[model samples]
Target: MTCKKNMVIIRSFKQRPVCSECQMRSLSGPVSDKKFKKLFDIDPKFYETSAFLRDIRYQYSLYQNLTEKQIAAFKRVVDEFKNPKKKQINAIVPKAPTKEEQAEHKQKRAKGLFQSERSTLRALRTK
Candidate 1:
């Protein structure tokens, strides 16, 4: 990540990451609403810049006040809640089954062990 100001040089092996102290001191004092707006008032030279980076920086500033352990716990909780394995959000509308799959599904449905969607399934044999 490149800083807007040439404050630090990041290297692969030897350089330390930007310290939290430096981050807090970059634009000092408790962030008031006016100060927050001032930090975000970028040079109007660029037309309609996205506020994504500014939003992230604001979040970072707010998070900086938390203790190191608190930050760790916050990260842990976010990770826990964002588990990829637990992702199960699905569309309410089901997809149409393929011809081969429809045959298997029909068999299962006949045996009363599976459910077929209300939509008619394509058949492998016409007659």
Candidate 2:
């Protein structure tokens, strides 16, 4: 649905009742609210994955003029996905190395193919 400030072009399908989703529409982008329902009903966890993340990210960008309430609702859905209680598998990815480990890593990086990989200007002439 296209909108400009106060005016909006609301959609009407032949079968379903009138949409109460104008507010929802503004944030969720051009994908009809019906699609959201169908996807959620099929699997509530679908939104937690990359497909839904990509959809919402695109929607957020496409519909930049959403109200604060709609934005909150959008964030709530994302937060629900990120809730720790729902975590089952190895969601806790590996941790970053300590500073000493990082220093060691940098030292390793400075020693190996790093020198040979340098630009021609940075490389020394043959002895």
Candidate 3:
């Protein structure tokens, strides 16, 4: 019988590796003309400028705050036009709701339903 010393090596085959540039691209919402210039050191063509601006605004609004790591990443992109080789920025992965959190959410939803029911009952009683 042959024994495997590194289970990770076997498991690695099952998972696909994603590059940092891809990860950054995924996290980035959109680049504005100004931001695009800052990051890429090039402006969008005259026709595409407005659309590019809108996209950047949308992305900024969508992500309320940029983390330090994200900011550093932005800077890093500006420093080097080439794709980042290192995965310095940690991807934000939302955690699954815990049992307690799920229960709390359910309780809040139930309370909202109860409030609506009570309001309806009061309205019917008044009429």
Candidate 4:
């Protein structure tokens, strides 16, 4: 039941060959290779996020050597994050009003004013 005994038993059990994984677990407790890989597996597009770069910068600040070119590159990256590129929006432009429409609007306004004046005159006459 103990790991040391399990390792010894595993070593003796040559008839039913213990897998390397079982040997490792017996020696070093339960360690999942899949979980380890999953934890450290970096995506190809991870650099684009800048988070991975930031982590690296934070973790290995002492190891960093910034030349003029490297400093410029870092500045560019910082600028990129500070002022991100704007995506082109498909904006709907309103159609300009035609001369005919302007004329029609003027006529409507004039008619409204004329009707109001006529109503006031009628009211005055009746009084």
lDDT leader: 2
Model 4 residue 98 CA deviation (Å) reads 20
TM-score of each: 0.22, 0.24, 0.22, 0.26
Q: Model 1, 26-93: lDDT tens per residue?
A: 53445556644553344322112322233334455666443456446544443454463544455555
In TM-score terms, candidate 4 sits at 0.26
Across 1-127, the per-residue lDDT of candidate 4 in tens digits comes to 2333334333354333433334333333222455333322333233445542433333233343334555456556666766778765545556779999989979978779768888999999999
**Stretches > 4 Å off in candidate 2:** 1-53, 84-127
**How many clashes in each candidate?**
0, 0, 0, 0
* lDDT computed for candidate 3: 0.48
Which candidate tops TM-score? 4
lDDT on C-alpha atoms for all candidate structures = 0.46, 0.49, 0.48, 0.48
- State the RMSD for candidate 3: 18.7
Tens-digit lDDT track for model 2 on 52-89? 34444445556634456655666666666667455555
Clashing pairs in 4: none
**On a 0 to 1 TM-score scale, where does candidate 2 land against the true structure?**
0.24
Where does model 1 exceed 4 Å of error?
1-49, 54-96, 115-127
